[model samples]
Target: MLDPILLWSGLVNGLLQGAIYALVALGLTLIYGVLHIINFAHGSLLMLAMYGVFLLFSQFGIDPYAALPIMVVGMFVLGYGLQRGLISRASHGRDENILLVTLGISIVIENLALFFFQGDTRTIDVPYAFDSLEVFGVFIAIPRLIAFAAALLIAGLLWLMIQRSDVGRAIRAVAKEKQGARLVGINVEHIYAVSYGVGIACLGAAACLLMPTYLVYPTVGHAFVLIAFTVVVLGGMGSFPGALLGGLLIGLCESFGGLFLGESFGQIGIFLVFIVVLLFRPSGLLGSRV
Candidate 1:
């Protein structure tokens, strides 16, 4: 049996990790839901966002958090243009084509970063990076706690946007039937572009939030993309609520798995859960049948 204290530590740590996974998966899920695109480039975009923050802070002495709004806006525009110019051409239900395009984009971004940054890993060392609180005789990492809170808060806001907002309704409409949406006075193209942009913006947000803890590098995005996809698939493609649950679940698994099985095996265990979910749940905790 696990010790009570270790269990508590794992629980909080799992929640924190889940929060990070949720934010990362949110962008991928959003694009998947609204645009029916897998967005393999999402992780690459996240890396770019981190680099963006890094450049701003390192060169201009701006705070990493302070550059967030700009990065979000810039990423949105970047996503919009990329989708409009490349992804839009793939059209609906073209899963293979969309995947190829996004994958290509990821490769391009990764290579560009490699060419520029030369594979050096870097992290944004914010004030109190190592700070944490003690609870029940357990040490909780402050940055992770903050990241977890931010992730949950944003996830909640995303849920509201999808379930309650007008734009959210339009996105759903477009997702269900693009032609019908066009007939109903919705500009499918614009919505598609904007949704893709929003997806990138989510990546930007995650990057900014993660700066204090994780390192920034050309291939950094690759490290976490698998976990992000696992969360998206396990939670339900295009389901923000599912993403949150999936993220937290995976985080907890990683925490406990690391404690018992070791960090390397922890990730493998998470992948196995993903496989099990696919075999049994298929649509994930919240995804719908297409």
Candidate 2:
């Protein structure tokens, strides 16, 4: 039997990891909610943002946290441009077309990074790399704590934006009824781009928060793609709060599973929970009826 302290530590770690997972999934869910398409390129975009943070830190000696605003704006521009200049033109009113386009984009991004960065894994060392916070006899890494706080703050802000902002209202209007939104002079195409940009912006924040503890490579995004999808599905696609809760739950499972089942087999728990959820509650924990 594991010590109670060990179990507590595992749970803490899992919650920390889950917060970052929620941050990552938030973008995917938001895009799906607004655009109604699965962005196969999301992981690739995350990979790109990680690279952006890496380059800034490596070349300019800037801290990852300090680069947050820069990355968010840059990614937003890239996402906006992609949506306005390519995705919209290519989508042609078909979700399948958007899927293909995003898939192609992912492939292109991976190859470009491979060609440019040569697939070498990169990591950053911050001043607080080894720092930790002691809480009730448990030591939690500072970076993990920061990630948890930042993720929650961003999620809250996003929820508020969606719930209260005028632009957000336009986004919802377009998401629910594009023709009606257009009739009301909501620049439907621009709203699509903005929504996509906001979705990608979340990844920018995620990359910065993750860089202090995570490594990056051309294929790093691949590792996250599966987990992100799981969170989205488990949380109920297009539901922000659902994604948040699902992420934390998945994180706990991974943590406890690793403790009891060993590292190699730990992931079995995630799959088990995923299957069980699908079998019983397909709509998800907080998701509405499908």
Q: Rate the local accuracy (lDDT) of all candidates.
A: 0.86, 0.92
Off by over 4 Å in 2: none
Q: Tell me the TM-score of model 2.
A: 0.98
Q: TM-score winner among the candidates? A: 2
- CA lDDT of 214 in candidate 2? 92
Candidate 2 lDDT score at position 269: 90
The per-prediction CA RMSD against the true structure, in angstroms, equals: 1.7, 1.0
TM-score of 1: 0.94
Deviating ranges (above 4 Å) for candidate 1: 90-93
Question: For model 2, how does the per-residue alpha-carbon lDDT over 1-290 read when each residue is reduced to its tens digit?
Answer: 77888988989989998998898898899899899999999999999999999999999998999999999999999999999999989889699999999999999999999999997999998989879989878999898899999999999999999989999899888878998999999998899899999999999999999999999999999877789899999999899999999889899888888988999898889889989998889888777796
Error of 2 at 174 (Å): 1.6
